[model samples]
Target: MKIDGSTVLVTGANRGIGRALVSAFLARGARRVHAAARNPAALEPVVAEAPDRVLPLALDLTVPATIDAAAQAASDVTLLVNNAGTHAVGHLLDMDLGAVEDVMRTNCLGTLRVLRAFVPVLERNGGGAVANVISIGAFGGTPSLGGYPASKAALHLMTQAVRADLAPRGIAVHAVFPGPVDTDMLDYVARNEPAFGDFPRAPVAEVAAAVLDGLEAGEEDIFPDAFAAEVGRVWRADPKAVERRLSGIT
Candidate 1:
């Protein structure tokens, strides 16, 4: 549960939230942090920051071989951050079935594959923690980005079930529900769905820092930013209300 002196592995470590997480690991005194991305070459800049502590690993959640290779290479991982995910921007009704499938494959099945490959590594290390970067939209969805939220909704449930299943193994699973993050992706989403433009966007650095804080504190459900925490409170009190609010059905 502790970050200091722990060996960490973060997926999707190329840029945005993932990149910040890599830095957070170093700042929080992780003994080693394997920064894994589809394109390991993109991780070079992050790995260079702390060449001694940061290791670049080639990992594509959707690619089983890459996931297996990363797990084997980062066998010492004490913490796993399932941050790699894909989003399909559109109304659920309008989105292509294939696009939805891709989202599910990447966000849900991909994460499962990585978890399956890495659980043994964690067990071998005696015990460890897993942090899954889900989204607030899991409880509901916006008019746009339907497939993205649907994928996250599945992951949200998976994280919960995994937490219960893994707790007995001395492996803690933390679910992170972040709201809109200030990234290129956010801008793209906004362009696709103007409604999302109204929501506040959290900085990537702050979100990453909050994630580490929650992990170190052993929080089961982490809302890393103000907007997410606010939504989390309501969702905790009345999930249906949050659902209705997002659905514009209230």
Candidate 2:
């Protein structure tokens, strides 16, 4: 929906794309923005930028208590942005089970938890929108990212299901599939897997701006960057071929 005059809540707002989203929302004239991060102290810079409009919130998606607390604290939120996620790069079979679980918990179940907690809030506030920051990896398996793609794939499906379920309630559900973004998360992956070193990355501000633009345009599935748009077009043209290509990327 519209960003202006809306109360928004964004998770993982400490840095990277999340931080950019918070700024974009403010720039678009959101009445208030709840910037949630695992560490509230890390949100100081964002809050300082707009002390009256930004509220720093402590939220750890994996922690149900923190999710509940954030929901309670941000009752006026009309737009919810599920942007917190983790990447444990490795082969699924060889990676530590704990790491896989962490990825699933934060990316899938944790996002679901936030949605569940916020449904009533949205309903009470006359139903708004939910924007989930998923990835192009959701379309196919990336051997290097392992369970990270699997978790996102699950989230993509969940976003579709939620969209259908929430339509009658007036709450819009948008799924964002962004390709490599210039963020710390991608930096970490590039450091560990040289294969990603040459992948095209979109600026964080551009991606965030495109996402909001998509929402304003009522797009259910948003490919926010050039790389993502190209990959999405190819994947839709031939899913199997794209899968095979990704499989060969090492």
Candidate 3:
């Protein structure tokens, strides 16, 4: 999909990869970008830089009302990026059931809701693209991260399902799998657990650039980071070997 002149909507745009995506999209000459975050005020810098091209929108994907409002606010969008995600960092058995539900609600259900709400808008705009920012964890188990991997796994499957469902309507769905990005999400884990500090982390800009490149190339599965691409290859080669590698990553 041609990013230049396309209208794009990026969720969780306040920080991390989402913030990078907003800047990258603008740099690529998007006509307009709807920067949606739980706290809309956090997108001040983004809006300041591209006031005429950026729309700061308040959105909590878990809440249907907020999703509705965000969709209405970004009705002109032709490209959609689902970047918001929740991670429950503990054993599922030991973790609160509510936290697990939150992960599922935000990462999977919320993404689907946004896509459903925007399909018509994308259709109206002449069938653009939808990019789902998934994670390498989706391809293999990361027991230490608790329900995070399971949630991503669901998103992985959902990405394919969405591609199948939206293809007929001219909407293209792309799944992006990034490994250990240098974002606040990784910091959150590192701060709480020292073991997470050792994982390799790539800058957000690099991952965002790869995703945009993948979109331009019409790739169905985008592995923006090298580690993630290797993980995919290993996964296809030997699932057990990939699992061992993930487990070994402190």
lDDT of 1 by residue, 1-250 (tens): 8899999999999998999999998998999999999998898899889999999999987789999999889999989999988876876786688888898999999999999999999999998999999999898875667688779999999998988899899999999999889977788778877777887899999999999989988889999999999989999899989988777711
User: How close is each model in CA RMSD to the real structure?
Assistant: 1.5, 0.7, 1.3
**lDDT at position 200, candidate 1:** 88
Off by over 4 Å in 3: 248-250
Which candidate achieves the best lDDT against the true structure?
Answer: 2
lDDT of 2 by residue, 78-180 (tens): 9999999999898988889899999999999999999999999999999999999999999889888978989999999999999999999999999999999
Better of 2 and 3 by TM-score: 2
Candidate 1 accuracy as TM-score: 0.97
Q: Once model 2 is optimally superposed onto the true structure by TM-score, how far is the C-alpha of residue 26 displaced, in angstroms?
A: 0.6
**lDDT at 219, model 3:** 96
Candidate 2 displacement at residue 181 in angstroms: 0.4
TM-score of each: 0.97, 0.99, 0.96
Order the candidates by lDDT, highest first: 2, 1, 3
Clashing pairs in 2: none
The better-scoring model by lDDT among 2 and 3 is 2
For model 1, give the 10-residue run with minimal summed lDDT. Answer: 241-250
Give the clash count for each candidate. 0, 0, 0
For each candidate in the order shown, give its overall lDDT on alpha carbons. 0.90, 0.94, 0.88
